[model samples]
Target: MTEQLLPENVQTWAQAPLPTAPPEPTPAGRLTIASVPAGHPYVRGISGADDGVVRLRDPLPDPADPDRWWPPVVLDAAWITQNADVVDVVHVHFGAESLPPGRLAGALDALDAAGLPLVYTAHDLTNPQLADQAPHEADLDLLISRASAVITLTDGAADEIARRWDRTAVVIPHPAIVAEGATPPPGRATGAFTVGVHLRDIRPGIDAVGSVRTLLAGLTDLRAAGVAAAGRVVVNDRVRDSDALDAVAALLTDRPDCVLVRRPRVADPELEQEVADLDVALLPYRHGTHSGWVELCHDLGVPVVGPRVGYAHEQHPDEFTAFEPDDGVSLARAVLAALARGTRPGSGERAALVQRRALARVVQHRAIVRAHTDVYRTVVRRTGASA
Candidate 1:
């Protein structure tokens, strides 16, 4: 049989069905699952899905506050306090931050009081900035110890938690949505044969600014090597004081040799489209365990460059070379080497390797959902669920 074709921009994957908790049997109770995401898009995305047990509203859309960590707790407490009987299980993915307001805590307490479970999936400090791991470990342990069951997206994350907390967590990697950047027309960049990229604000500290400065200096060297590059580095100055950004901006303001523009975060597709024009993507992060962005590039067959902090062992481990976070001299050589390599496909066959690998790396998330259903089954048996 011939293979059928689908639209390029279609989002083919979706959350799998919940088996443990069958659809509302008769007028029987519902599986009230309360969840909230770190970002507004995820919050709106998941909550709007008809599959959730207890749909939660999004919190304030501020992505810069260090204290705005427990967005789920805020969204959850609101639901449970007002309608405790409706929320059977509170499922949340967040880091170790203070719980929401007192009423919300009271609501969560009420759920526990009623024998409902609180399930938490840890995706916090995804790229931790703390100098010491002890505090981070403690915070994570505290949260997991309190949760009825814990879920994670990587074996790395599972190992990190089990080693410290003396408890195991189920591994479920994040899944992928469909990518439509198979073919782009005309010049790859603003100019012929040039590549463009954007590294949004690394964070709100001095070290992050220093990382940007080092990357800019490196891009300048790449331009000097004749690989014309035009891109921007978004800096969320609101995360810190204006003085911090002003100081960082000074370094780029004088550079006429390179086109180093600065801007804010944008929609996902806009960013992806920006990446599609480039032959390669540059991470240049000083710290982090893994990156979803790197996955984005590899999935689309767009080569990536950066320090070795992303999920290197799994995707393009040999394809990457590291550079000192704040050292301009070392970064300069690395950027030049990356720009010299070509990423254009020939006869629609070149990117096949990357396209296949990206799909394989992403399906792990679906496996995660299956594992979660198992946990739900165990919980159901213990709770005397008819299903």
Candidate 2:
């Protein structure tokens, strides 16, 4: 039978067979990463306690300007030409959003010319920044097809890659972001049910108004059913004049139960506190492949009511409740279910439990680092032998 043709943008070799070979020895010594926002919680948490096998750090383009760390120079063909020797291998966690497909292809060609291996963690199958996924899809196809090895956070995402691109990706769960030794928030006060939804500048995939409206309706139902004596839905967003923000402002005028916290932007500590204070947090994403936010909420001992759009529920089934996409009624029902379950356990026992869980999570992260290191070694070795 003749092989069917793929789209112009889809990687041609995605359907190719894998070579059988003995496993390569694990790569050792300082391994640096060129992750977008190298200091992001996800990247930083990968080291887990202090596993010296991976010396992961994002090389700053400008030492003084932290913002310059993004759109990482490692992805530049010219930069890779000069600096491929600086790092043993290039592992791309992110930073493809800003690069055009042509630029990314150039970077891949540079890596090939330099005889340097490339590893990509498929963090976002669909970029939430763009409503239209074509560009991102094309970019992902190119990267996945050319990558030395691919890694993903969830089985669902891995399956999608296999189905769409005919490539198998190693599945690794995202690491917990909460500090291993950090303290968990005190349990909720008696009779108070606090559910939070963050609407930050009305990001593309978030239906902020729809989420808020659902939560408000849910709160009303919970109070009427006597499941909650008192309820408060804390909605945090950057103060902006958008349809979502306007609707929130109008809702605040009519509803005394809702508290709208307006801030220009929430810092890491404050964001963590916002999730820590809630009985349950709602993630209002219309579409996403997975969520580090859900992992963080779990680490903080807060359950998440997330949309069924992606693998948020799979990330932590115990801590996540999924509602149908854009279905206000489903979300309302999920909220009520969370309220009926009551607040998380008290500080003493629960805090101790969380601390133990945090330690386990640290170990999990170390394993992830080790796994990536293994892949790096395999790719570098195979490429070297071929050379």
Candidate 3:
């Protein structure tokens, strides 16, 4: 998609002059970071207790609803300017989607005025929540251009960043999602294959309805072939009453081969277990870059069937099977191919494997933390010396 021209006001702000005061010196000892929405699973996964980097507690946007952190306060230019003394650097991951181009430019301006180096992890080139890619590309154009350092999860993404923005991004592998020592639930029954598709709130990036239809079709074919197979379509309470839910329900009517399961949003552990139990986890995303869900499935040793949109297959090529987005036949074929590979190890062996994987991830997390720490220190040292 072509980059959208930023609004005139944002352009004007980008060229406008600001205060010329040097930022406060880096705090003694460990570096303090003001991460945008610091509580996200990805951020927590990469952080280590001994990494010598501390992420400030996320500011509550709503006092009554403490969990809501959208429109991250840290991204507010005023907040960055006021609290610039406490943080050595500002690292942004998600939550920029909450701000418009003008406001986001202002935040960059504030970082400049405060002399706080900005480290941005490019988690998504295209925001899945929006159908139009231009708005998100516009955001990327601004953030990537002004960021002091950039990071991405995969080589393909890093290359794309270079091609699109002429910026080099440090390629850091995504850290493990499931915490160590968390036991997954018992595996599903033998001789019966289960395919799962999670339509969490029906975001614009996900082809929820089409994905369900494709899985149902695939299940029908499997049953006809004398294979004992079932399909599970899961949706959260957020889309329980929406037209998307109604459409999905209509498609599943009288279709006993597939069942639609609805429930409230689940915590990370529970969600991990749910994914671990499936024979094949289907990612129904129509567009986006990278995937935490793919990583979750990989952590639990579940094979994934994902759309061929982003670098998800690159994350774990052996564990991922790609399909044409929104194509029922292609998705069905991919599901069959995934199942043909084989089911996960028996419960006893699988648990031991999971433990080993989790233990190894502890080491991986430390390395990821170290990589981030190095990036933070580089920017802070450069800025400090220049100041």
Local distance difference test scores for all models: 0.49, 0.67, 0.77
Which lDDT tens digits does candidate 3 get at residues 1-387? Answer: 001111223332333333234335544687888788688777888888788877887775554546655566677787788778778888898877666457788889999999899999998998876777887888899889999999999999999999999999999999887665566554655557778888887777878877777777777766776778778888887752388788899999999878888997787666766777788899888788988888787777778897787788888888788877556667667777887664553566556666667788878888898999899999999788222
lDDT of 1: 0.49
In the range 128-204, model 1's lDDT, one tens digit per residue, is 43445555555555557766778765677678778767668876555443332233221133443333334354342
Off by over 4 Å in 1: 1-30, 38-84, 95-108, 126-139, 177-187, 190-202, 205-207, 220-231, 235-241, 284-290, 308-321, 329-342, 345-365, 382-387
Best by lDDT: 3
- Where does the lowest 10-residue lDDT sum fall in candidate 2? 1-10
Model 2: what TM-score?
A: 0.84
> Between which residue pairs do clashes occur in model 3?
none
Q: How do the predictions measure up, each by TM-score?
A: 0.66, 0.84, 0.88
Considering lDDT, which of the candidate structures 2 and 3 is the better prediction for this target? Answer: 3
lDDT of 3 at 132: 79
- Candidate 3 segments exceeding 4 Å error: 1-27, 326-329, 340-342, 385-387
Residue 346's C-alpha lDDT in candidate 2? 59
Top model by TM-score, which number?
A: 3
Candidate 2 CA-lDDT value: 0.67
